[model samples]
Target: MQDDQNRLNPSPRQESILVCVSYGPNSERLIRRGWELANAFQASLTILTVDAQDDNQYSEARETNMSLWESLSKKIQAEFLVAKNRSRNVAKTIAEAAKEKQVTQIVIGQSARSRWEEIAGDSIINGILREIEHVDIHVVAVQREIPLQQEDYEPGVQAYLVKDGEQDILQFDPPAKDAVQGLFFQSIYTDFNNGVFKVTEPGKVTKYQIFDGTVTRKLSETFSP
Candidate 1:
């Protein structure tokens, strides 16, 4: 709810996916699952609504027709897109949107699928897949998204030595301990992948060691100081 800067550009968008809803009986379930899936992959959702309408103006009215469903999507804090067009081109429009948004996946209503459809006469689902080059699609029947587990975890710090696949030379001066100086599971970078890190106490370097090619005694006798 904070400003854009506070939101962190939407979490790096692990995957860009779009969902299409035909507003059928199962539309609600697909949207709910899409939301859950987006959160799981850290992806974004685009809800597309396709109908027999001829233009985009009346699409708003159609959406208003489904205000209750929209409210449901909001309840789960999921992103959605609503599109309205002639049924003949609805699938195409959805595919176009998928490409434009760089959609990683597509979720659509059950009405678009057929169990034993053939290739010569591909189903709407197959047509969408065949045309959309880069996007993947996920069709959901029910609330397929599972809720994330909330737990309390204790975080600790650790360190690692990094190089361009080679040892470096530097006096074993401890890294900056004023901020997170310790052994952490995360990795830091150095010149050309040459770097070092250590775990410290009070978030300070409790114990540290380093050997870099750039300094005298560049290679220390692997000692834990």
Candidate 2:
């Protein structure tokens, strides 16, 4: 009778949740959702990001996003992991990480591709399902308030911002002492270097409006969160 009672009341299985994110505005939403699930289940939480390039080769935007994610993970008392995928197989990397972490649940953002694209076997979720077994996956749909807009500026170029007295000057030449390295996007409508300058410093990402090679205002002021 005792053996049968013990068998009927099995111990609850421990749960670990892994959240996969990329460099985008939607990453924070996904992380928060993961946090909610982790709290509800009283499980360990982890934030994982897969990079296709080396750490030194990451773009300014990617670096900034990583920094932000790391800070957020720390705040939530979760482990932040960055995995390099030299072969660019992101799903395989994620699955490997999940196995290594003994994760029981995964939370990922829904792909922006249309249903047709997903049906054609281009979805990463499909690959992950094939790679892992006995793990629950949650695909969160990201809602966009506005449709993606066409580019109003030229492609971003590696540039530097040098402090010139009280103002900052944007230059294409090599960085000088006390210079901030970032990506500069020039407005295609004008001939001068007028657009936006983006830079990541420590735990913060800042953007400045540049007009005629000079910073006009802090663009981050207009950003929401």
Candidate 3:
């Protein structure tokens, strides 16, 4: 495999390489692959992510993943960049970054989208090819994360969390008068009380998980007044 790669490239040194990553567990793999290639060629490596909105506009999970990716990039001695593409043209943003960095090679994950899906909206891979010139684009195949079995909790039902003494228990039925009310989403296939309970805040709806039989701290704060 090494000989094949060496022969294909002839000159085995790449000056600058950029990796484009999206949200999800596949990002780690993309970064590692990019790092390996960069190290092999003694090239500069940069990681880039494009978002339609600012970080604050994204979910906590998205922010957490971004932080993780940034930390991993630092550990690998690669530059990390994020661009806000309000028009949602992720390919154009990445292409622009590649041009600015003078990236000789670009590494991106293969799209999980099916053929029909690509027909609806042009694939990001195709978009990048059209926008960039003379850059060797390496498409890394990625595995989709298997979702966890939802057998730990009962099927979701409209429920409520009621404070009993110092603890809060989930009630599948409606609460009595003056009882703190919120929308409860139960987990699948369990007898015990569990899953996220959502309550409206001043301007947003905050969700808290009910573990065992208690309201989380965030839930407590929402109804403190």
Arrange candidates by TM-score, descending: 2, 3, 1
TM-score of each: 0.47, 0.60, 0.57
Q: Which pairs in model 2 have colliding backbones?
A: none
lDDT of each: 0.50, 0.79, 0.70
Evaluation by lDDT, superior candidate among 2 and 3: 2
Relative to the unseen true structure, what is the C-alpha lDDT of residue 65 in candidate 2, on a scale of 0 to 100?
71
Candidate 2 residues 25-108, lDDT tens each?
A: 467678778998999999999999987767567588886677667766866789999998886667788899999999999998
lDDT of 3 by residue, 138-191 (tens): 988876544655243444456667778776677766767445566766644223
Evaluated at residue 113, the lDDT of candidate 1 is 53
- Greater TM-score among 2 and 3 belongs to 2
True-structure lDDT of candidate 1: 0.50
Candidate 1 C-alpha lDDT tens digits along 66-99:
6644544554555556655544555576787787
Top of the candidates by lDDT: 2
Worst 10 residues of 3 by lDDT: 111-120
Segments in model 2 whose C-alpha atoms lie over 4 Å from true places: 1-7, 112-121, 144-225
